[model samples]
Target: MTEDIKVDKVVDLKGMPCPMPIVKVSKGIKDVEVGQVIEAITTDPGALADFPAWAKTSGNEILKTDQQEGLIKFYIERKA
Candidate 1:
């Protein structure tokens, strides 16, 4: 189940490809406070796996992930 999170920032990478979405998400996460959440919207299919792996290695927390139509949304909380 996904948590009802309050996102502090939204990084829209909807027409972008693989690495770009991850890159934007990485940068966007820094824009929020340490405990704040950042919502990353991407159309890249690779993001489904990339995000969770990246969040784990980067020490961040992914609160939720939802995929609808062609868009994927990741709610990531900055933990480091």
Candidate 2:
């Protein structure tokens, strides 16, 4: 895990499933500035694998991710 960055909002996707977390995080990050971070908290097991791929495909940056207490937290930065 990397150091936590200063993020504008923390999206809690704990109960959400699959692409929902990814979709919500994608939408939420759009309004943020370039280099600004957003923290996504999700319990969706697939996010561990999906998000990083999405970030890469979308040209965003997944700065860090950590699994804690069965939840996954991803710190993502908008590239544009």
**Which candidate's lDDT is highest?**
1
For model 2 the local lDDT of residue 5 reads 74
What TM-score number comes out for model 2? 0.91
lDDT of 2 at 72: 91
lDDT of each model, Cα atoms only? 0.89, 0.88
> Cα lDDT for residue 26, model 1?
85
Model 1 per-residue lDDT tens digits across residues 6-58 = 88899999999778998888899889889999989999998888988999899
lDDT of 2 by residue, 1-80 (tens): 35547878788898997779988988989878988889999999999899989999999998888889999999998997
Per-model C-alpha RMSD = 1.4, 1.5
Runs in model 1 with CA error above 4 Å? Answer: 1-3
Evaluated against the true structure, the overall lDDT of model 1 is: 0.89
Point out the worst 10-residue segment of candidate 2 by lDDT: 1-10
